[model samples]
Target chain A: MAAKNGSEAAEEHTSSAEIRSFFDSAPPLKNSLEITDKLKEFLDKNSLSAGDGRANRIVCVTSGGTTVPLEQRCVRYIDNFASGHRGAASTEYFLKAGYVVIFLYRRGTCQPYCRSLPADPFLECFEFIDESHIKVREPHSEAVKMAISDHQNVVEKGQLLKLPFTTIFEYLQMLQMVATSLRGLGPHAMFYLAAAVSDFYVPWKSMAEHKIQSGSGPLDMSLVQVPKMLAVLRKEWAPFAYCISFKLETDKNILLKKADMALSKYKMHVVVANELSTRNEEVVVVTGDEKVSVCRDKTQVGCDVEDPLIKLLVEKHAIHIVDSCS
Target chain B: MAAKNGSEAAEEHTSSAEIRSFFDSAPPLKNSLEITDKLKEFLDKNSLSAGDGRANRIVCVTSGGTTVPLEQRCVRYIDNFASGHRGAASTEYFLKAGYVVIFLYRRGTCQPYCRSLPADPFLECFEFIDESHIKVREPHSEAVKMAISDHQNVVEKGQLLKLPFTTIFEYLQMLQMVATSLRGLGPHAMFYLAAAVSDFYVPWKSMAEHKIQSGSGPLDMSLVQVPKMLAVLRKEWAPFAYCISFKLETDKNILLKKADMALSKYKMHVVVANELSTRNEEVVVVTGDEKVSVCRDKTQVGCDVEDPLIKLLVEKHAIHIVDSCS
Candidate 1:
């Protein structure tokens, strides 16, 4: 909490105590029971009781950006700009690879199948035939058809479970809950951490009760470093899960170095290192042994690197299952 | 830009000079020319040369929240939580009252006609019949039809000109451009300012080229106060326009006092003071002479206070036009 402000941020609090204290001081989720119930239903459907030849592989994909609220009532926040495009695209690929995907995303961000449509003009893309009937406009008709059919099929078949979080507190808590819930799947469960989560936050108990007044001169706020929950997720919550974390940087020189640090420090199975300018075109996968550059087929129109990236990960997860069993 | 940090925020610079310096230091707009051309076309379509009995009234409605980027490349930002419901609703009322609206908004915020649609599951709202046809699902059919028809009609006729912005730099530049463009309308122009703008910002010149590396001790940043452009707007840019600014506060105790200060200091014709919790239920119209409480009819099921609020503002604007001519 703000009790130990930024100056005292990382000097103390062993990983366990930090995680425990962070959760202890956070405002309890308004709908934790509902989220838990939904997770239980989702897990029950994918349970081994189905008697399928092999347990269905499940992957939880976290997407979009998390906020750091500055007030208890939440008038202002610290945020990041993430279109959730990579996560959405990756989710589509994972589902196509026959993985049941839990899409943990920020509300109102880009969704798994709706990425092709124009960001604006949601209503403009349809022709109003009548009060009850509307036809999709050309150029958009095929995209709309594919999006709805694919989305509906996955959601109805219970292959995609969507959970949304906004604040950093909600994100970490939900991550813990999801990791723990998927614990029984062992090596079959994968955690693809793609969300741009806040690194620092003003703890709930220390937040202002009302909107911070302006014209009050330079606002000096003491934001505490958010506890590194990746360590907790790998070590305690889902030890057997194949975990992949991401590192994005504007400086190419420092990107791989940071990814290496995160890989070793958090014991991440693989760290996807991407630079800001060329993220969509290429990325480097950093693991214990080597770094592999994954690039899109630029010669082809509308080709995404996510296709190959997810395929590669699926293969890795398959190998992981074998390694764990042996 | 960061030459004078928050400590020297208010020490110097006349209102006009502050505005000048701010604009000079800001990053140039990527599409200023396009925005200007669109604004010109919109204005010319409603020009007085059409020999109409009276000049067409036009209002620039600024909506949603602006972001303050923490770095030059902008991996992080300070933002506020705003649904943009009030501004969107008010634009509809303004258009209904026979005024053309230039909706300057944050990209991806709510739109005037699309408010009733579900925030998530955009694709699920439609039933895919075939490649070319889609039917609106029941319970949403009527809303979709109305939203599409109304939005299309306005946009096609050029009655609603929507300009979107994200950062504080883009917002202020766009506002200045819109105001200066409408300067010819005189009292027929109205400025409805509702966007939750940043009060402090990391000056562009001083911002780091890359993301601020964490693991560094308590990130100490000296944010400069954003130059107040309201004074410049009233005294220089659109002096004769009927200006209405909004004040939103969490504490009701200081709301009116803040509103009064804004009214006198900025010479605003009306300052709409709204408390955060009760904003939709009621607001106090603060002006030179009096403060009047305006509330929605609690008896009605789907009533909104914006209807009555816009009606009163329109009446007041009419009086201002008459007074301006004399």
Candidate 2:
């Protein structure tokens, strides 16, 4: 699986062989086998083995920040800015839209339906009503109750499965396992690439074994571009699955341009473009044919932009499934 | 407060003037003034204005990892590896030792009594007993009750104060504010430096105003050393405060050497040294007079190393207080 020798290609464009080599050279996550087995078992019980003639539409929602380790043991890392709020919020909406949600998230990031709570939710949300009894605080009681019920309802129906990862290596490995397992589902599978993945990383073979010492004057290191796996995902992993990737930029001038490039270059079905400052308020969904603006409803108390975003994606996914079947 | 020109004398050695200059040149935290005022008020009420002859001994425990932003708008950052488990666990022990604790921690990191809870504690700990009533799950009920009461007890007594920061700028600014505020307490003040602070950063003046464009060939940038603030803390900020700093290393051969260097260079009262792999199981406490190996007790069901660690520190602090008076 390693790339052909002397394969240091241009930094901007990475070939499939280079991408494969990147994965081949990196050490596999300790729990990759266990996680793959769990994913297979989940799919079998929830979709494949079900008695119903029709299989449920399933979407993999990747959330939070993927860290690029500078060392093999990983004392330091480069991280994209993300709290997993968007992914977690979107997972809840996806479940509401009747899609089986595989929540692949960074460990300790925000969780679905728990986004509305305070940072230290458990400590701040509960109070001792009496000596022996404790109850949710009055101000947070309604939200807590609703979140619990909604979460429990999904769990009881076996519609939500959560898998967690911390580093870029773990995330990519798990993503591959998920995409391969979903291949049998054909067009019924969807990929929501919401996680903030790092664009560059220190290759595992050249990384320092111990913590990088600060005593050595200035720290100088070179990082290689992360292989564009979107192309491989579309071409080889799960060809018929509808994939939507996200593009977040601080500069509005280049946002749509990058999204368009991603759509064309990776053969992505759609790209969700968002500005770093205004991501919560609005987004632009760029497809091969059109660009649609999505905004949160100001009139509603808790309406999120994800409501409309997921609705549009589900509609597009439905059409794709039907087109493939015909 | 800026250092004199031509200040870059040595890479590893940072003068106090240079450290102060780093703060002066960097952008102040948005909430520094407000946070300082709050700290002052809290200290006044809890320690300075108490009617009894004795003032409360106060310790500031810093936890979690500080981030170094690669750009001004900060779409990406370099992060240190820390889950803050040790610091959070240590806070509970400090409170049990009858000292007021000001927990200065990275946002979203673990909390003192909430250490053992699940990642999404509130969501996982609660369930619907029936249609209208939600209650804590049976298995977690006892723990939930204990955590809540213990947290509330300290909160009500004004013994615990939590201040959260994310970036290196915020962490350093807040630490300075905290140290200066505790200056009046003399020997009664203690500092537990547990936060995994970044070793290098791009100065705010030189950082890109927007998200760094990945289109540029390879990211070639130079990061300046983060000015050593421990020396400033000991010499100027709160001279009489008993200070303990942590030294975490991946190589066991150099662990104690680095700890000793930190102790001598920064004039710290103690330095806790541990290897990354065995940090949980054992640690070496390095003081000027001796080095002691502290290990977790195997006989106790739930005994943590922090329990004994805090006890030793408290005893050392008490002696320091008495020594100062003599």
Misplaced by over 4 Å in model 1 are: A1-14, A48-55, B1-14, B48-55
* Candidate 2: segments with Cα more than 4 A from true spot: A1-13, A49-55, B1-11, B49-55
Q: Each model's C-alpha lDDT?
A: 0.84, 0.84
- The deviation in Å at residue A285 for candidate 1 is 1.0
Model 1 per-residue lDDT tens digits across residues B201-316: 77788777788776734555566678878878887788888999999999989999999999988789999999999999999999899999999989988678988999999889
Which residue pairs in candidate 1 collide? none
TM-score of every model versus the real structure: 0.95, 0.94
DockQ of each: 0.41, 0.36
TM-score of candidate 2's A chain against the true A chain: 0.92
Looking at candidate 1 chain A, the ten consecutive residues that score lowest on lDDT are A1-10
Q: What does candidate 1's lDDT look like per residue over A248-280, in tens digits?
A: 999999999999999998899999999989999
lDDT of 2 by residue, B159-254 (tens): 888999998888898998999888888888899999998887777877888776555244555676788889889998999989999999999999
